[model samples]
Target: MYSFSTRSSFIATPHESMAELWSAISAALPVTEAEFPLDFSEKVEPSVVDVLKRCRQQLYTRSGRWRQNAQIILDLSWEKLNTGTWRDVDKEWRCLYSYGCLFKVAALCCDDASPATVQEAIRTCDLGLLMGAAIMDNILQTIVRILQNEIGKRHSNEEDPSDGVSAKKMKVDCVSVPVVKQALAVPRIHCPSLESFKKDYLDPQKSVILEGIIDHWPAFKNHPWSIEYLQTVAGCRTVPVEVGSRYTDEEWSQTLLTVNEFIDRYIVVKDASSLGYLAQHQLFDQVPELKDDICIPDYCCLGEGDEDDITINAWFGPGGTVSPLHQDPQQNFLAQVVGRKYIRLYSPEDTEKLYPHQLQLLHNTSQVEVESPDVVRFPEFVKAPYLECVLQPGEVLFIPVKHWHYVRSLELSFSVSFWWS
Candidate 1:
C-alpha cells in the first residue's frame, strides 16, 4: 500500500496513508519492553520498533504537509543518537526490515563489557538522543515511500512484466545493468554470492608483477592523476607511502630507491584506457579462463596465491574509476598497502532502505555521493542506509560483497586484495 501510486493500476487506499500505516504497524508488531538497562539507574533502551511507535503517535497529529519532515527527523536521530555512529543504527534498521520482523531488535540488548549494549544503551539514552534518532528514522522512511512508489509506477507501466528486460536478462557492459540493480535494491548492504562465483571461476595460483601493481597507485609520488585531479580540486595531494616486497628486505630497499628516483622525476598518470598492457583484457585474450570469471572490466585476477582458493589481483581502478554504491562479487579480504581509501558498507537487509537499482545482474545504483545526498537527482538515495569505513596502510576490511560499498582514494592508491569464492 505504501508503494502504490495513482499512475499505476494500484491506487492509494486508506490503509496506505501515514496514520493508518502506522496503526497497522503498531498493531501487527507491538514493542517489547527493554526489561534491563546497562546501568542500574538507567532504563533499558527502547527497541527501534518502540521508537517507530512514538513517531507514528506523533505522525497521526501532523498535517500532511509535515509528514515528510517527521519521518526525516526520526531517521536521522535513529542513525546518529543511539548508535553513536549513524552507520550502526542504519544497519540495525535495515536488518529489522529485511528479516521481515522487528524481533531482531533483541540483537541490540546490553552487555556489561560493552556500554552500547543493544537495549540498555538505547533505553538509557537521554531525550535529546531519542528525539534525534526518531526524527531521522521518520525522514528516511518517507523518502523510501516516495522512491518505492516511483519504481512501482515504472514497473507497472511495462508492456511485458514477465518477459521484460528485468535484472535476470540484462547484459554486462560499460554501464552494467547488474551493478546498477544491486546498488539500488539495497543501498546499505552488499551481498556477493561467494558460492556462485567460486563454483564458476575459482582460480588458484594467479601471478602478477611487482611494478605492475604499483602502476595503478593513484597516490604514487609521480601519479599524474593525483596531480591533475588534486589540482582541479585541492592544490596539493599528500598521501603516505610504505613499501614491502615478497622478495627479501634488501631487494625491497633496492626497489624503494628506484621508486624514490622515479618520484623525484615527474608526475605521470598513465591513462588506464590507453594502457592495454596494464589491463587484464590483453591477458584474458591470452588466457581465456580469465575472461569468463572476470566480474568487472577493471577487476582482474593477477595470479593465484599459495593458500587455499586464494587469488591475488589488482582490482585496478573502479569501472567508473569511482564505484557507485554496490557490493563486490566475493568475500574480500582487502589489503590496502599503498595509498589511502574511504569505504562505506551496508548490510544485506538494508536493501529496501537503499532503494538499490533492483536488478540482479547489476550491483550499483544511479546514486552518487552518499553523505548529504543530492535529494533531487537520486531521490531514492536519500533513504539508502550505509556504514562508512576508511582504510589506511596495513589495514584490511573483511567486506562481504553484496554488502553495498562506496570507495574513493585520497590519492592515487594501490592495494592488493585476496578474494575467496
Candidate 2:
C-alpha cells in the first residue's frame, strides 16, 4: 500500500534569489483559477474575483487594511456556519483568508530580503495559517518555507555550529526547592528489561527515570535543538504562549506570538513582570522539520500503539516557569532536551489527598501549590507524599496515567513529551 521513489534536486530552476522565489510562486498560480465551485455555470465565484483583484492592486497603496478585510469576510463566513467558531468556518472562507494572505505576501515580496521584510512576510504566512484553510495547494507553507529556509541558510553561513543545540541562557542555573518529608527520589533505571519495568514500576504505577538510552537521538547529536537553530527555523512561525508564572495563576493568559518574539520578550529581556512559556504545543505538526530530529522510544511499543498513535508536545520557556500539580489521561515520557526541571510526582491513589480543583475545566489539576503549600487549607497534601527528581537533559521520566506531577524549570528549558494510552 506504500511506496517510495527518490528524486534528485527538487528545484530544477534557479530560485536562489528571493525575487526568483516570488516569481516561481506567482507563476504557480493560474491567473483566473477559481477557488470554489459556483453551483451555476459561472466561471468563478464573485468573492474569488474580488480577492484576486484586490491582491493585484495592493502594490499601488502603502496604506492597507489586510486583516481588517479578512476579519470582515470572516465574520460573514461564521454566520453561515450557525456558530462563530473560527475552527468550524466554511471552506469558502478559508480560501478567502488564503487570498488575503496572498495579497500580503505579494506586498511583502515587493521589498528586498531585509530582516524586517522577511520577518513580516513570515508573520503574514503564520497569520494565514491561523485563519486560512488548506486551499491554494499549501501556498502558505510553500512561500513561508521558501522564506524560512533562505533565512536559515543565511544563519548557517555565519556560525561555526555544533551538535550542541541547547538553551544555556537562563539566569537561574539550579533552582532548589526545599524537600518536604525527606525526599523519596524516583529510581533511575538504565534501559531495564521490559518485564522488569512492567513488574517493578509499570504494574506498581510508580515513576522512574530512564537513562543512557536517548542520547543517540539526532536532537542530541548531529542536529541538536539549540536556541540558535530554533530561531533560524521556527522563529518566524506563530505559537500559543502562556504569559504568567504558571497557568494556575489568577492573571495568567494565553497569546499567539512568533517564536522569536517569545524569545526576545520573555527569554532575552533583563526584567519582566511574568514568565512566557510555549507549553504543551503540538509543534511537530506545524513544523515537521523539527520532528525529524527526535525518535520515538521503543518503550512505547510495549503499549498497544506506535508513534502515530502517540501525542507529542513541546515545552519551551525561561527558568521559573512552573506546571502546577496536574494529572494527564495517558501515560507520558517527559524527555528533557535543553535544560533541567525539578519534578515532584504523586501516585494516582493519592488523588483525594491532592485536593484537585472542582471546576470542570481544571479538574485534572490539583489546587495544592507544590512549592508553598498552605498547611491550614490543604493539610492532607503533606500526607500524599510525592517523589522528587531533577530531570536533566538526555533523561526520560515515565509518568503513568493519572499520576499527579508538578514540574518547574531550572534553566532556559526545552522539553519534549510523548503521551500514549
Q: Relative to the unseen true structure, what is the C-alpha lDDT of residue 389 in candidate 2, on a scale of 0 to 100?
A: 85
lDDT of 1 by residue, 1-421 (tens): 1222223211123433332333323322223223111111112235544544443343333223233333443454444445665554454443323221121111221012122232221222212222223222332233223323333344457636454213122212132122223333312212324443333322321111111222333333333332222222211111111222111122222111112122322123333231100111122222223223322212223223334455555433222234456666665655565556666667666666665655554535533555446677667666656555555554445566456766655444545565655
lDDT of each candidate versus the true structure? 0.35, 0.73
Model 2 clash pairs are 165-226
Clashes of each: 71, 1
Top-lDDT candidate index: 2
lDDT of 1 at 216: 33
lDDT of 2 by residue, 167-235 (tens): 334344445654534458888999888888888988777899999778999888988888877876688
Residue-level error in angstroms, candidate 2, position 208: 1.5
